[model samples]
Target chain A: MLETLNQTTFLHTVVAIGSFTIFTIGLVGVLSKKNLFKIFLSLSIVESSLFLFFIGSHFEVGKAAPIVADGIKLFDGHMVDPVPQAMILTTIVIGVAVLALSLTFVVNYYRLSGNIDIDKMDELGEVQ
Target chain B: MFNFEITALGNMFFGLTVLVFVSLFFVPNKHRSVTLYSLLFASLACIFYASDLITLFIGWEIMGWSSYFLIAKTADKQTLQKYIVFNIGGAFTLLGAIILIYGACGSFVYSELDFSAVPSGQVTAITILLLLTLFVKSGIMPFHYWVVDSYSQSNDLFSAVLSAIISKTGVFAFILIFFQIITVQYLQTPILEVVAWLGVLTSIIATFKAINEDEAKRLLAYSSIAQVGYIVTILSIMGSLSLEAALYHTVIHTFVKLLLFINVAAIIYVSKQHRFSTLGGLLYKYPLNFILLVVGIISLAGMPPLGGFSSKFLIYTALLEEHKGLLLAAVLFSSASAFLYCYKLVYGIYLGQPTNPKTEAYPRIPLRFYVPQILGAVILITLGTIPGVIVPMFNGILGSVGFEPVLYRGVFVLGSDFASFNGGVVIGAFGLIFVLILLFFVRLKNRSVKPKDRLDISYCGEVPRADVNLHYGYGMGRELSRIGLIKMILSRSSHALWQRVSTLFGDLSGITQKLYTLSAQNMGLVIFAFFTILLYMGVK
Candidate 1:
């Protein structure tokens, strides 16, 4: 059953469903969180779900990592598609950068306005 | 990927306007300002030469930001805010249109946009979006909220460039997008009709606004809108003659604004004043500048023996050729009404007696200030005397853009199937008549009345003091407000419409903001609910 679960179609379906569920949870957290920090973390969670969906769907059972090693004989379908993994790696770095930058903005906002709750933040002077 | 192609239309506009930009270098400005100015020139060149939507967009964005920074140097925060918001909105609309075009054509290249394959409805939608961008850039009614403030607030010399050169970029874009990429055959008829009406309406409204404006630059700014309105209207007609008319008007309006603005800038530079209330009796102090401004306003009013008349005549002829009777009437009305403001512009600054006592103490205007004014004057005079000089160039532009060449009869004459005019005769008759009057005036010098005391003007039982406000410039246009139509036009503002739009956006943003303020548990529940909805949709 475990081996069957690792099959290509089965694994891809499971990853799609699981990552989508994670994305939904993050989306809900982002929608409902009062704290700026929680909202940003929730956004990061959503981004991670996207990365999982990209990388996990490309994985194949019994395939070697896309690296040249003593056991790995040739560069072919025997190795899982490496493009999605490479893309995910770049995406993760960007995600982290964005999250870090946003958090800094949030910190600055908190210091300046003294409120982490987005509802209470009105530095732009918008009418309620 | 980057691609640029040269067309005669681009050459005509860029070649003429670049001279204005190059002339700015002669005017003293900060090094950084010069750098920004050059950047704007390059971006405009990019826009004119761009063969692909991506390149066009990049240039459009650069032009927007560079102009923004240039304006921000002197503009107040509110003015800067208005400029950025409107320009960014225009840029986003342009981006959307480009993306939509790319989706339909599967390529960014203008040459490859095979709209025949796309559905007509989609094409119309894309055209409307593209038009929205052009409308905002051109400062048409409803989208023109930023123009008056930005023009009034920018550095004086840059205001000349803004009105003379930068505004024409929208005209260039209209020619490029509507005529070239989305050829006339593909455009829906009713939409073009609507565009034509919008242009004429903008002109009528802007003319009134211009007349009522006390601030000199703001008046000129409104005049620029009104002038471009005619171009837009003619362009919407999309005939060979109409295109020529639009191009001619574009060229004429550029020089007219350049001369007028720089002339005002010189006055402002000397007197340190921009309002009509404070500026007067400047004719004797700066006679050369005064004459140049007179020439400018004459041409701008489209009176004969000036370059303005040639273009205006061409425009009227084009409208007649199209049998657009109502449009012709409306345009003629606007053109006639323009004479009042033209008179106001001149009388406000040069004709009226000096209002302030310190007017006599203003410093001499620098010689460098006269360079651009002189260049502009020479060009206008040449175009006025030989209006046929640009006909071939206009024809070349038309041919390159795949439009039929307009009929040309002689070196000094321009005509279509309907009517024609001789620029040489117009200028010759006017010059001879003007010289005769001047000679007669000079010959009768002995008949001149003796000069009276400066403060000897008659008053109703009260002698007016030196400090009394005797200048008619301040109240020149005030009585125009008594007219019902003029009163209505002056009272209405586009600001309320834009405010409504922003308020709607604010409300939408308020709802979205709430999503970020919910508790953690509620967020989790919302997430589950969203997931369940997505799953159900997927299953269905």
Candidate 2:
């Protein structure tokens, strides 16, 4: 029991560290970056961390895939929480949709003003 | 849980299936009736089969795409793309929130999901996600950036749909989630109070922005945000009274925005003029719509004896119940200021003298053009006249959320076992007084007060070109702009925050995008990083 408890804690510690690191990297990129394209890309990274954390927290010991093979079970805690995985799947699809849409925005921005820099947007507040 | 009935499934599939096929039909330019018809069918489907979240999402995404294509007609590709991107971003937030809930409970039906089961942290995350999505589409405060740009760029009638039906979906979604799925008490109130404050702040600032905007469509867009801010404020209260208020405001706002956008669209269509400085004296040109728009503006302004006031009345009561003296005062002040811009939208566009009579305006508006707008406007006025007519409907809508049913006796009355405004009495008294004034005015008038052209006033010592360039939209929202502290730094756009951030992003992406331009390298890195992180976690 103690060993299992220690292992669970260790797994959580890894998850906490990894997702936070990924999040930090994205944050730093978003904060420090000067390119519109890179900012959007960094946002994707941040989104990935959120997905990772969600999926990671739901992970438990001794769980097999929820998908029913001949002897496999469904929705048992022995399996990693399917909920977070399913949510991540949906979020991933949505993230792709938003990314494609935003990238198109970048393309249009480039076409209109021939400038891809955010600092170049002069028509909005205080820019001109 | 509501079972995914074949009928419901079929309705959603119709919109989904037609999206690709209809895209082709809309590809050939000038095929408007077909485009409008397809959208109407899809929108109707969305409205009817609102039980399942996933089914609802399909309708929402397809609606977003359909509207984007329609807006492409009036705007250049870039504006259309921005419009689509911003809307899609909001829609994605919603999808994330929905998926979060479904994941939590293993159900997509709105009816069966229980909030108590949602882990506290997940609930907060889900709420924030839902809030962000709705806030963007609702065009509240910082998210108002896309509102003016996209609405102004869309084809005239399409702008009407953009303002009216689309934004209301945000409110509907809020009602579903916040009022229904998530218990507001379990969530944070200070956050909602802040949202309320933001709503009020946006109203004040955007009202000023609207007044100063020279572009006709942009002015209306800002005005739409300001009105939406009021609706947002009411929604934050999360009570039976507030829910009624929010829904009432949502309905009235839909009609009012459609009224204003349709009139503007008709004006743009007829005269090929968009800016107020370039056009004038339209009260006679589009008489029916001008009156209709006036009714909407008055309703929007929360003036009494109109559909606007009924909803606005509820918002005020909700605020008072909270007993936030300052916030209530602010709400009252912002709405009072709303009247000024309401005046500006009407007088500047319709009542003022035309710069030159010879300047050609668009020919008479088509009847089909007026049909939808008139239908919306008429419902708004008729609702105000008989406030109780829709009280039961609101009761039915709110009933799904398990909120206490607000008292309705042909007029909504709030204040449980305490103070309340009897709307019928107040409205009836006002109506009586109005009739008395009309009779007196009729008795006093006749031969002496012959109504003539809207522009009987002097246009001269005349410089027609100077008149055309005159500023009509300046400094309307100035009073409320003083509260600049409300501007959020984290939003996609606010006070040049996004602009500077995007610029920095642009510079960095310029370097990295090239480095990652090859999919092979980028994919390898992504997969390797993904596996490395997963392995590290799994092994630990």
Candidate 3:
């Protein structure tokens, strides 16, 4: 039973369900948030779910990380596709940068307007 | 990483860019203005020489922002906002069209486009998108709300550049994209017909608006729109002769606007006034400037013995050749009506009695102002005397753009298969008649009696006071607005449609903002519901 659980299809299904669950949680937080900080955090959470989906879908039951090391001497099918993993790393860096910048903006905005709740923020002076 | 190629069409516009820039340099501007002008010139060159759509787009963006900053130098916040918003919208539409073409052809290079292989529907979509971009840039009808404000509000000399050279970039893009890349064979007839009608209607409306205007620069701005409208109309015909006509008009208009705007700028510089109500009796004070303005207006009105008439003649013959009788008639109507605003322009500033006592004390115009005016006048006169001087250049442009060469017998004659005229003969006849009239007037000068006092004329058996109102310039075109046709045209505003569209976008953003204003937990719940819906669909 344990060996059967190692099947590629089963693993893919598990990864899909797990990422979907995280994505839903993050999405809900984002859609309901009034605080600027919390909304951004929720957006990052949603982004992480996308990262998991991309990397996990490319995984095989027996494949190792793309790195060549002690047991793996040559590049072959034994290593999972490296492109998606590399792309995810880049995405993670960009995600961190964006989050930091947004948080700084939120801080500045709070200092100026004395409000962090998006509902109370009306810098553009739009009516109702 | 970028490709640049010089086609004949590109060369023609690039030559115009150089000409206008050189003329602008002599206008005595600030260092910052000069820098911006150079930047604009370079960007225009980039656009004209671009061999690929991406390069063209980059140049287009630079041109837009440079002009924005240039206009921002003298314009108010609202006008700047309008200019940026509309120009950015136009740029985005152009980008969308370029992307669509790239998607279909797998390349952005002009020579690589394979419209023949693409579906007709996609081609039409791309053409419409590109046309939308050109329409906005060229200030065609509904998209023209930003033009008058920007032209009126910008620095005087720069306004000349905007009207003279910057506007033609749109015409350049239209010729390049529609004629070269898309090719006329693939264009649907109905679409061209629609474009033709749009051009004519814009001219008619803009002519009336020009007549109704009180400000000098604003009137000229509207006149610019009307003049470009004829070019657009002729271009829609897409015949060999029509293209030549369009090109000829483009050259004539560039010189005319440059001369007129600078002439107006000189007046404003000396008098510190812009409204016709404040400016009058300036002809005697600045006789040379007055003469320059007359030349500009006569060319603008397409009167005989000027370069404008030659282009107008070509346009009429082109339309007639195509058997577009109704279009030709409408064009003629607008041309005839243009005379009213042209008269108002001259009469309001130069021919009428002084409206204010301060008119006599205004400073003399600087010598530098005459440089560009003199250059423009000489070019206009030469083109008028021998219109065929530019025909060879236009023929080369046509050849590079893959159109058949227009017919011409020599350097003095211009015509197609249907009709022809000798520019030299027209100018000679006009000159002889003018000289004869002058000689006759000079001969009769000694016999005629002069009035003892200017205000001595009897007004209902009462002498009018020195301060009594006598100037008719301000009210010259006032009755035009009362006409039924003009009244209806004046009642409608293009701004209303654009405002409605903006409000719709605002409503959409408002809805999104509401979603963004909710509590974090509620947002999380909505996201969960969205995810569950997606999962449900995937499972099914």
Candidate 4:
């Protein structure tokens, strides 16, 4: 039963469902939260789900990591594709940096105006 | 990256730029910046000499922004806004056309452009876009919303530059891009005819508007628009003679505007007044300025024995050659109406009784101001004396642009096989009559009594009150509004049309603004919804 469940299609299905569930949770948090900080945190959670989905969908059982190490002396088709993983890693780094910067802005904004609720922020003024 | 070449057209424009810029040097203005002016001149030269669309656009943008800064020194916020908006819109259209051409031909260079590969539809689109750009620059009507405000609100000296040099850039580009690069083979005659009508109509309306203007600079601004309109009309004929006619008018107008603007600037400098109501009897105070202004107005009105007439004659002949009888009649109607405003200009400032008490205390105009006026006056007179003198230069330009040179016998005669005139004879006859009149007046005058009090003369056989404003300048063109056709023309304005366009844009942007809420929750919902749609699309 374990051997049968470990099929490529089954793994991809599991990855998709799990990531979709996590993404939905994050989307609910983002939509329900009024606080800017909470919303940003939720956005990060959504980003992580996307990363998991991209990486898991590209992964294959019994495939070597895309690197020339140990038993893998040379690059070959036996290894999983690394481009999507590499792209996700860059995206994660950028996402973290942006999230940190935006949280800092929220902190400073709350200190100045004594509020972090994005709903209450009318600094751009009411649109005519 | 930018390429430039000195064609005969470029050289002619450069020469005109030098003449105008030199005259600008003698103009006294505390706000004047040598750096900005130099930048302007260099950019203008770059535009005139540009061998590619890229270089032309770069120079065009530089010209626009630099002129904005120059005008910003004296213009109000509204005027500056108008100037920037119209000019930038024009520049963007030009950029779009250039991009379209580049996509079609795979090159920005004029010589590399192979329009044969371009679809006729795309060619028309490019032509229209380029024409729109030229129209805005030249302050052609409907696109001329910024012209009056910018010209009048700018410093007196800079106004001359704006009118004389800057406006001509449009004419140059029109000639350069249309005649040389695009070449008239791709152009449709109906489009040319429509342009001709637009030109004549603009002149007619602008002439009436000039008559309505009480301020001197504003009046001259409208006149500048009207004069450029004539050039546009003549140019639309698209023949060797029409091109020559347009070129002649361009040259004459440059000098005419320079002379008139500088003359007005001098008057403003001494009197510290711009309105005609407050300015009168200045002929005796600044006789030289007055005389120079008279010469300018004569040329402006396109009378005989002036450079204006030579160009006007050419324009009429060009129109006749095209068998555009109705258009010629309309142009003549506009030209005839132009005389009313020209007379109003002279009568308001120089011929009437002094309206302001301070006129008696006005000081002598600086000698430097006369330099440009004299230069302009002498050039106009010379051109009037020898109409065909500039023909060789124009012929060179025509030849360079791949057109046959218009026929001309000598420097004294102008025109082709269709019609011709002896400039020398016209000037000589006028000069002789002028001398005889002067001699006759000088010998027979002495019976005229000088009024002790200007209001002492009984008006309608009743003594008018001291406070009564009798300056006819105020009421000069008010009657034109009462006339049926002119009233219809005067009633419509481009301002209302532009205002409606702005409001429409405002409403459109307002719709998009609704989605840009600051609420993080709402923004998150939008993002989530957008992502879901993308995901669904991908999955499908």
In terms of TM-score, the best-performing candidate is 4
DockQ, 0 to 1 scale, candidate 3: 0.19
lDDT of 3 by residue, A7-122 (tens): 98888898899999998788767776778888898899989999998888898878877888887777798789998988999999999999989999999988898999977765
Best by lDDT: 4
Q: DockQ of every model listed?
A: 0.07, 0.02, 0.19, 0.44
What is the DockQ score, from 0 to 1, of model 2? Answer: 0.02
State chain A's TM-score for model 2: 0.87
Model 1, residue A52: displacement in angstroms? 27
- The whole-model C-alpha lDDT of candidate 1 against the native structure comes to 0.87
* Ranking of all candidate structures by their DockQ, best first: 4, 3, 1, 2
Candidate 2 structure quality by residue, lDDT tens digits, A15-61: 88999999889866765565778878888998999888877777766
Q: For model 3, how does the per-residue alpha-carbon lDDT over B1-540 read when each residue is reduced to its tens digit?
A: 378998888899999878877877778654346677778888899999999999999989989999998989789876887899889989999999999999999999999898989999999999899988888788888778889999999998888888998889888998898878999989999999999999999899999999888899999999988988898899999989999999999999999999999999999888888988778878779999999998999899999898999899999999999999999999999999999999888888997667777887898899988888988899888888888888888889888889898768467887877788888999999999999999999999999764444465544488779877666666566787689988888878766776797789889999888877655456556777897899999999
By DockQ, is 3 or 4 better?
A: 4
lDDT of 1 by residue, B325-379 (tens): 9999999999998998898888889876777668879988888877887888888
Could you tell me the interface RMSD of model 1? 7.4
Docking class of 1: incorrect
lDDT of 4 by residue, A1-128 (tens): 99968888899999999999999899888899888878898889999999999999998888878987876677688989989978998998999899989988999999999998877888874545
Using lDDT as the yardstick, the better of models 2 and 3 is 3
lDDT tens string, model 2, B1-540? 223433322332243334323322322224366756577556646643567887777777777777777776668655664566677987898899888988998888877788787778898888888888788877887666677788898766666667776776677677767776677766877778788899888887786666556677888898888888888887887878878778778777777776777777777767777877667667767778788877878788888777787788778877777776777787787788677777777876776556545544357876655665666667676766666667766676666567777646444443333245555666688889989998998888764543344233244475344323343433334444455542222122453664676678878977776554433324445766788899999999
Report the backbone clash tally of model 2.
22
lDDT of 1 at A122: 48
User: Which ranges of candidate 2 are over 4 A from the true structure?
Assistant: A1-128, B1-44, B360-362, B411-505, B516-540
Candidate 3 CAPRI category: incorrect
| Candidate 1 lDDT over residue span A1-128, tens digit each | 88787688998999999999999899877877888899989989999999989888888888878997887666897888888888888988998899889999989988888899966754443345
Clashing pairs in 1: A31-B515, A32-B518
Among residues 3 or more apart in sequence or in different chains, the pairs in candidate 4 whose N, CA or C atoms overlap within 3 Å are none
